[model samples]
Target: MNKVLFFAHLRDAVGEESLEVEAGGKTVAELKAELAGKYDLPRLETVMTAINEEFAANDEVIQDGDVIAFIPPVSGG
Candidate 1:
């Protein structure tokens, strides 16, 4: 299982800061698809992804115990 973290408005949308998902051997893109479908979140496409505290590519494979964080775009003045 992978630990998926949602930050900013994403956490509010999902109603949770983190969730555990079975995504071992799946790519980040696949996980995104899963989340979008499950949560009805279309904005997920614009979020940045990190795996285990390091930025990860969409094609990066997920492993068990990995921490996946979805960071929504932020705006500042």
Candidate 2:
């Protein structure tokens, strides 16, 4: 299983800070697709992604037990 972490509005939208997903062998894009489908989050693709605390590309492959974080762009005045 892969741990998916949510930040900022992404967490509020999903109603959780983190979730476990079956992502072994799946690419980051695939994981995002699954999450968007499950959570009905249309903007999920716009968030920045990180795997195991390092920035990841959409095509990055996911491994079991990897920690993936989805951080939405933040802006404040």
Candidate 3:
């Protein structure tokens, strides 16, 4: 299982800060799509993704025990 974390609006969308998923072998894009559909999340195209605390591209493959975080853009004045 992989640990998936949500931040900002994404956390609210998921109704939790984090959850475990069977994401090993799936690309970041795939995982995002799956979660978005499952949770009825907002469009994730602009969200930043990280794997194990390091920024990752959509094509990056997830591995077991990896931690994935989705950080939405922040706006403030």
Best by lDDT: 3
The whole-model lDDT of each prediction reads: 0.89, 0.88, 0.92
Error of 3 at 16 (Å): 0.4
- The residue ranges of model 1 lying beyond 4 angstroms of the native Cα positions read none
> Evaluated with TM-score, which candidate comes out highest?
3
With candidate 3 superimposed using the best TM-score fit, by how many Å does residue 52's alpha carbon deviate from the native? 0.5
How would you encode candidate 3's per-residue C-alpha lDDT over 1-77 as one tens digit per residue? 99899988888888999998999999999999999899999979889899999999999999989999997876868
Q: How many residue pairs clash in each candidate?
A: 0, 0, 0
In candidate 1, position 42 carries an lDDT of: 55
The alpha-carbon RMSD values of the candidates against the true structure, listed in the order shown, are: 1.4, 1.6, 1.5
Candidate 3 has an lDDT of 0.92
Q: Where is model 3 more than 4 Å wrong at Cα?
A: 75-77
> Candidate 2 clashing pairs?
none
Worst 10 residues of 2 by lDDT: 39-48
Query: Which sequence of candidate numbers ranks them by lDDT, best first?
Result: 3, 1, 2
